[model samples]
Target: MIQGPCFQILLLLGVVAVAAADRRPSFSYSAPRASSEESGPAQYNFNWAVNDDSSENDFGHQETRDNDNTKGSYSVQLPDGRLQTVTYYVDGDSGYIADVKYVGEARYPDSDEVRSYTPPRRQYN
Candidate 1:
């Protein structure tokens, strides 16, 4: 593995780009929320990275409640080989979700660091 100067520069730039993009996450759910807490439906983004067993495929099983929403329960894979689940709910333009529950290799969800879930930050539960 050659750590050339040019390669290092490119790597740095790539890291910067990824960081910026991650900071600005867009809702990938069907029933996306609007800014209007009174008229528009609530919006949210929840995802977890499943690094269990370091599988080549990154994916997670999740159920997105909101029978009226376009889609429900989607298995999504992140950039890395990690699995995660994201769901959404509308509470009068104020949506709610259980956070990106990562199904670890144990084949179950973890309860640690459950407080990370927030309106903007993608929390895990």
Candidate 2:
């Protein structure tokens, strides 16, 4: 019974708001699938994300020491395909990848962790 231009505009606004709220981007990752038939640690590439590419989730990680204001901290993926949060310190002028550790398990990966390889041994010269 409420038919008016104002009602239409309000309905449109409500729809837009709902759409925006539903479009939340996920910061979590997918863990790689590993087969038990294999041996040793399965290789799972990390989804490394720089500070610029991180979401609000990174700010609330427990590894932050409850300090959500950490400036040098970043999110990355580990070899186990685990999504990790890495912290870095500025070395001179440029920033480099520092300490990398597993923060948690990733929710996605390009490949599974079923296969892992080692480099050939070489004698030191």
Candidate 3:
């Protein structure tokens, strides 16, 4: 039978071994919850990343939702080093609309004019 210092050392080792055996690395993660009647309407979101090392034709895209409308915006680098952004949105039965803008000290084409030009109908002789 062990006694004194030897007994104490053995007891300490046994306790340490038991504690180490009970220890293990653990990981936990929670996934997103699904939308249900109790949880209300569903949500939508999207994001994309572009490589900056690519050529001028490279572009970036992003999308988001608000109420009944979903909008998407795209950004691209033009040959003249100016950044161009185009955004569009779609809602219920209202259809889709888009707009373009130039982001730089100087804009291209200077200005833009939209005219509602309608051609006249011709009568048969």
> Number of the top candidate by TM-score?
3
RMSD to true structure for each model, in Å = 23.6, 24.2, 18.4
Provide the lowest-lDDT 10-residue window in model 3.
110-119
Q: What are the lDDT figures for the candidates, one per model?
A: 0.52, 0.52, 0.76
- Show the lowest summed lDDT stretch of 10 residues, model 1: 63-72
lDDT of 3 by residue, 30-98 (tens): 998776646545468888856545333557899988777889999887756677899999886788888
Write candidate 2's Cα lDDT for 27-121 as tens digits.
97788878768575332323333332322222222222112222355564454546665666543445454776775666553455335534345
The TM-scores, one per candidate, come to: 0.24, 0.22, 0.42
List the candidate 1 regions with Cα displacement exceeding 4 Å.
1-71, 96-98, 105-125
As a whole number from 0 to 100, the lDDT of residue 87 in candidate 1 is 54
What is candidate 1's lDDT per residue for 54-121, written digit by digit as tens? 33454454444343342334455554324566554444445554345545443323466345533334
* Global lDDT of model 2: 0.52
Question: Candidate 1, 84: how far from true, in Å?
Answer: 0.6
